[model samples]
Target: MTDYDIIIVGAGPAGLCAAIETGKEAKVLVLDRKQEIGCPKRCAEGLSLRWFKKMNLKPKKEWAVQEIKGAELYTPNGKSIKMKAKKAEGYVLERKIFEKELAIEAVKKGAKILMKNQVIGAEKKDNEIELIVEENKEKKKITCKIVIACDGVDSLTAKMLGLNTKLDLKETDSGYQYEMTGITGYDENLLHLFFGTDIAPRGYIWIFPKRKGTANVGIGIGAYEKETAKYYLDKWIKTQDGLKNGSIIEVNAGVIPVGGFLEKMQADNLLVAGDAGHMVDPIHGGGIGIAMEGGRLAGKHAIKAIKENKFSEKDLSEYTKEWYKLSGNDLKRRLKGRHLLEKLTNDDFNYLVDSINVEEALRIGNGTLTKKDKTILFTKKLITRPKLLKLMIEYARD
Candidate 1:
């Protein structure tokens, strides 16, 4: 039996970040079911340096794989468009090193980290929560005034508390990824994205280079009936030109929730952050940055509530406000954008691709899109396909 001021479950980026922040002021306990930190990595490991600066954290050299300069977009018909970054873009992180670094930082700040502790469930009573953990076939209970469930998507801890953890069908996505070692002819600084019905019906395929000769190629598809992520990924790997010859080193399957925000993320004595709260970006299905943002807010809010001796739903509402302010509006806009993408038919996609090429050519010839350019592009796209324009209008309104 151990009494701690705060207990954080899960040792992912979000959980480790929470421990690092809260441990500065309180007796924090960080628990992970895994035997070692950063094992069984599932992330695509893509992050921008701008976020690191905004959060006041420096990037450790050992954790960064490569610096990305831009992203290349490929339409369904194999036509490509490269969007060169204007600034130092992002990084392909070595997640194993990244996760361990955060854990070590938390430990240095006086947080007690308990590895191999599997949290079975939790019990809330008298304004406090007791965590039931099992390690080495022995049962132990951790009592704490605050519990932050930084567990990844579909968190059992949030469900055990009877919280609202449902994701809408349209807002949910299934992911399949592979890390390859023998791939060649890949640009370390440029990531590639494939879009179309065959590649991904409602989503897209991504090729993110991790190192000089290695890359993480993956695809995310909307969760639909009788349509599995594995099936599509297997088919795409074989047919897609870029990945047809690459050897698969490792494969991972995961789900991302892109639906709007959950109704309630905080309870009497518990707070949920990161994927447990479904905070991933709706358009790109990226969760690393959003999870870090959520964890940062949760840490700050939890400290405020604990210091005031008031851990209520009202007190934790501040966390939700800060989260929305940081990324909620973007999530809302992207959710609508995802819907528009889903409504596009094969013909609509072809038309849109051609329209983009024409627009790009015009932009290249002139500096940027002028009023006449906008009018010409808009009229051509609208007259050619009314439904696509309708969908675009819907997203614009959102």
Candidate 2:
């Protein structure tokens, strides 16, 4: 058996980031099931400039492929609202390159990354956690003082370690995406979103351009929706002139944990981060930045745990406390907004399209409303629509 101070599962943003931090002081190892890192991209790849600044990331032309100036939101009736502002500026990333670069940085920090390694089982030994990993069909046991499970939605590692990371169907979103090429008629510098019950069923379709003629076209819908995410995505594509003839070079399906955040994200000698802990935005199903933040925090706390030689659940709970303070409270509020949006009908959506301006739309979409913003939303924008007003009042309450 081999020994490491910390073992991070999943080489995506979350695992690699945790390794980057923990590697600075402790011996760290990152393992992923994928044969090639970032080959099967599972995200829309739209990360905001705000997150870029928060994460202290410098945009690289090699991976930050497209600069997004704004977003275009469309109603079921096809009315569009263009939201362009300095705060909204961001980028579409070439995630394959970006993730590989993250791995390199983690390695530079002295973390070891082993690809084609799948952790099939985990058990708590006397003071360390032993992980049974399969490498090239050979099974081996590795002992680590702590385990950070970043295995994403449907995290098996969390369960294997006796943590309940199960997600309710209502709290999970079915995501389907296609890397498309040779598409036209949309602005390459802006992200596009289309919303309707018939279109997405409690979610939206997104187009994040990676280049002049290529984009990531995807849809996120309730996991229990009668129609599948791909079904709705394909239906919408057939109606669009720009996307109907586009070629799909790659396709992937995944689940997003929109809510159902774990109140306790740690167990004895184990920690869960990223999608494994439901550290995703409830409204948009965006997890990359949130996952990275979770990983970084977990890494920091894990270091402390190692220093004190305290790997108990009580000792590791500080990470969960800080995560709630940093993101959980706000995400819980956003969950209310998501619930409200779920109740909107096609007519209500179209009504909302005409009621709000670009700024309010952005606020509502991002779930960043203030007391003043809520007051204005209810008093002015939703005044006439009593149904929507009631809905907004119900959800807008803090």
TM-score of 2: 0.96
Give the TM-scores of the predictions, in the order they appear: 0.91, 0.96
lDDT of 1 at 88: 54
Q: For candidate 2, give the lDDT of residue 330.
A: 85
Query: Judged by lDDT against the true structure, how good is candidate 2?
Result: 0.90
Best candidate, TM-score: 2
Best by lDDT: 2
CA lDDT of each candidate?
0.78, 0.90
What are the per-residue Cα lDDT tens digits for candidate 2 across 5-59?
9999999889988998888899999999989888787799988887898789999
- Candidate 2 segments whose C-alpha is farther than 4 A from its true place: 86-88, 365-381
Candidate 2 minimal-lDDT segment of 10 residues: 81-90
Q: Kindly list the per-residue Cα lDDT of model 1 for residues 98-209, writing each as its tens digit.
A: 8888889889988889889988979886788888999999998889988888878757887776677777776788898899877776677888888888668788888899
- Per-residue lDDT value at 327 in model 1: 80
